[model samples]
Target: MAADCEAWLNANPVEAEDLSDSFISAEEDNGGSGGTNKNIHNEINGNWLSSSSNNLHEARLKAKAKRRLRKNSSRDSGRGDSLSDNGEVARGTPIAPTSPKSKLLDRKSRMGKGRGLPKKGGAGGKGVWGRSGEVYELVEVDKKDPNFDEDQENCVYETVVPPLDERDFEKTVTPIVQEYFEHGDTNEVAELLADLNLGPMRSEVPSLAVSLALEAKASQRELTSRLLVDLCGSVLSHSDMESSFDKLLRDLPDLVLDTPGAPQLVGQFIARAVSDQILSKSYIEGYKGKVDCEHARAALDRAAVLLKMSLGGLRIDTHWGTGGGQRPVIQLIKEMNLLLKEYILSGDGKEAERCLRDLEVPHFHHEFVYEAIVMVLESRGEKTFKMVLQLLKSLSLSSIITVDQMRRGYERVYMDIDEINIDVPLAYFILEQFVDKSFRMGIIGVKLRDQCPHRNRKRLVSEGDGGVVKFERY
Candidate 1:
């Protein structure tokens, strides 16, 4: 019966890929499942229409109708290429369902040996066991391993372009000096210099900058001067005076001589430095000597020329015009002395000491000590009296005032203080302080012992009950 059915199917093949849908559609088109089921009903003696069989047949009819509708739409849309003439699904066509409950049905009804059966496992194709329980074997794919080879050739390369000198110069040096000119801080400039390995050549930076500025057009000259002024000021104001100030002092004369209008600017700076006590009187004096020596040498050279010209002289009258020849040295010395004397006279021991550090003459300490004592004694203020003695002690320790200088300064101060209505015996308090400081310092030079004024000996020995006056001379 199956062969006869197959022969009939071969004679009339379905256009759609699903053969089960063809059978269901043919039965439905003939009448319905009711007609076919009626034949089975009669064959089963009216008991053929069981609830399960009826339900199965109804689900099959619904699935067949859905397939027939899909096939009609595909044919109208020109998608009938998915159907084969021999009732096989074309490659890439989806498998159609047998019924809505296809998943619940046994595998026997869902899959069978047919033209639309899934392809067997070959060359990595996916496969399942056949209904007879034959297993599909899995195929292994071969892969090619990668091959690596190293190629090494001459790779060293040199820059074909010349080294950029200006760029490097701008990077390493120009920016630092430019910033220094913008901000007048020597320590910052020094740090920058150290970073660039130009620390030791610091003075050169400003000198070079000034030269460049001078060579620039007229419009930039003022800017050059201003930046140079700031740079020089920073160098002078640096706290590391031993290095910064001392080096500048050595380099300054040459800088001033070489650069035009430099002496005037430098002269102004020196004046400011002295006024502010940023530099010592000794430095000012040395600067003065340099200027004077240069001037004297120039003058002598002119005189020698004049003397030589006089041998053929009708008369050569050459007028000497003063230009950049003025020296501030002598004036600076007067200022130093005036400030020092004022501090001493005011009984300001601290200020006097500050001035004392700048004094060009060490012998002048005796004068300062004497004047300080006299100021204190005359004021007769207890604080002033103590300040003078402390100042003298400080001077002695610094070796600025020797034991002998103190002895003489003491006698002179005592006599002056005594003449001001201070008790003659009270004057011994001052002398006693000197003697004690001298002894404490291990200075027993005969000048101190011998210079003790004969008349003040009695005053020095006289006892007093004042808080500071009564201490023993020893």
Candidate 2:
């Protein structure tokens, strides 16, 4: 039995307890018999230990192999089936792959909810968590429908403005006409009028424009005439313009109360409008003999007279004549120069002053001052200078040219004195003398003397005895 146990132990060599010392001690105490029994016990113990360890290792390896197979099987299930290196399926049954969406649906179904989180506190069913509520079904919209919109629903709305009556028209149009008078842009006025719902009172525009111009200045009348021509076919129809003039003719008696020359001005407006085709030729013919009011008759007669003049249509543009600041700068300069030349040749101070007054440009009198000073500087004779000086004094004394204007004029000359010196070598000296005389005459202020530019006089050089150079100051 001991030999069989030892043979089993040799076949499966494994770690076991050391029994050699116990067996040796037993043999010494009980001879051959006790030694055999001790060997048998040791062999039994070694056999038991080896068999238990071998069984445990085999069980553990089997469990490990089973776990590996389960892991591979799970991985292959997700990818349909395991694929071999040769691109062949290595599976029992090929499973279909699951999409993420299907997987999500499966997960949701498993949780007993189709989509979204369970309602707060377990209240489940549609909107803001579940009591009975209105359910909205989303329906596809037809894009071919006329009222359909993708981004927003189509909406219809209407804005209506009350039509202007005669009184309302006057109130609304008064400021527009005034602004037109200032800017003098007919297109702007037309654009403004286009925005208004004039309705049946459209005829009132022409009459109101002319009436306002009559009460205002000559320039306003000219602008009003131009506006009538521009707005003829556009804003104001031919019929509207005719009706407007009829109203103006009827209102002449009232208009003459404020503007004594209203009849004449209206006549000019009518003639110009007719010539420009804004008013029909038959317009004046219609009122030829039926006119009752004397002012109206006078206006009609004046219109007739202007229409009969040669080149009347073209000439009527200058009927008002440019006045004050309205006249072109070049024209004003020419007229002023003529007045100065005439004054120099004739020595008539009153006539020169009268001509300047008639120019109607008190605002631009500084230009005259600059021109007169330039004339004096350019001229040779003392008499001509004295004459220009006398005219300036006369203007100053009469208050036609303000002291401020005179000072500005001298300052302008001072600013350009260097340029003037190119033409007139004695410009600085002449300017100084003129300023002194004018200051003493009270034509220029006392402060003007300090403002005048001083030019350094050139030094005279001469050779003295012993070849020495001497400098003489002017």
Candidate 3:
């Protein structure tokens, strides 16, 4: 019985216990004592039944199991009754032998869940490295036998990505797509490319390129608006794709914007353009006058924030275009001023200060700092002015001190205008600078209304002050 069980284990593989169970059960019914039970006749075909049929019953069980086996059958089908070696399918059919591996892969994948390894073969002691492309092998269910390797046999795959056409259209297509994007003409491009194929798109053109484009569309829409899109074509020159690209990039909001790296690409282009102007600074700036490379810098900034870009990636290679003698410090201050104003309008003092810190324009002089102080102090309340002074004097910019300054300033000048017994006219002009920065320099003055232009503007003049006069129209 031990030998029999061992034989069964070897031939049938104890791992497939259900098969073992079936054979054992049928054998017990036939009486293991070398005789066939009458019950066996009805359960199995009678042609092989024997009076001394324990052997016959065993033969029947084996035969039934072989017939039911899912693996290769070339094993025992010799005289149309006996199996040949290695249990293969009968010759002449194209179907290959059904190994334990191929069968389970088919079954498991059908369940909508995928499995990593197969049940047998291509691993462990004997049959591993069995085929090419079998990079690694895994162990069997009990870690008993070699199980699976994702070799050519196991990991059958189908490559569907269309091969890149080295010369056909990529060069032409890449520029066209970029240009269209720069021009804010994606809708036009999409329309033109509608129903178009890369050569010829399959119905599966749910293919990669199309899918990527689809994923990119929603973000593009959110970042772009019709007004800004028009600005791209109008404010930015069509010939300089960098201009349009930079414009679009700058329009992105500080929060909830497009992918971070996006600006880097735009920035690279702008940097290149600026470098070009720099390389040709004599001739180009002579013609263009004070080149607005600010757009380019902004594009680079957007790209850096969006793409998390590295400076090494930029390809700036331009010679000077103009103002060879003038340093960019003044221009940098102007840019910083614009940014600062926008930051204030957006109610983000923190970012405005950071911008001031990062300003690296070589021309930034003490005068610029002094100008900044005058502008800040004159336009803001006395208390607010003090806070600006404190922030400048502080070793490191601190938020707490800045807040305290603002609170004191607002309370002092804004809340108690009447106590000063000051000239109402001078007071009106003095306070109005908070509304328009130019008021600080006496270049222009502002009117105060509680609401904005379309609505009411804040009233800069104090209540019951005879000097109060409403501000003028735009």
TM-score of each: 0.25, 0.54, 0.20
- Name the candidate that leads on TM-score: 2
The deviation in Å at residue 236 for candidate 1 is: 29
For all predictions, the C-alpha RMSD in Å is 24.0, 16.9, 23.5
- In terms of TM-score, how similar is model 3 to the real structure? 0.20
Error of 1 at 316 (Å): 32
Order the numbered candidates by lDDT, best leading.
2, 1, 3
lDDT of 3 by residue, 54-101 (tens): 444454556566665634344333324322235653442223334657
Candidate 3 overall lDDT versus native: 0.40
Cα lDDT of candidate 1 equals: 0.47
**1-474 in candidate 2: lDDT tens per residue?**
445545555675533222221233445556645525544433434564455454454344444555655655664554445644345676654333434365446533332334565545455645454445647678878889998876675556667778898789999999999999888899999998998999998999999999998887666778888899899888889999999999999999899899999999999999989888888788889887798899999999999899888354458777877657788999999999998888888888888888888787888999999999998887745776677788889999999999888888888999999999999877777788888888887777778887888898653233456432222221
> Would you list the clashing residue pairs of candidate 2?
none
Go through the candidates in order and give each one's C-alpha lDDT: 0.47, 0.77, 0.40
Q: Is candidate 1 or candidate 3 better by TM-score?
A: 1
Off by over 4 Å in 1: 1-351, 402-408, 411-425, 428-430, 441-474
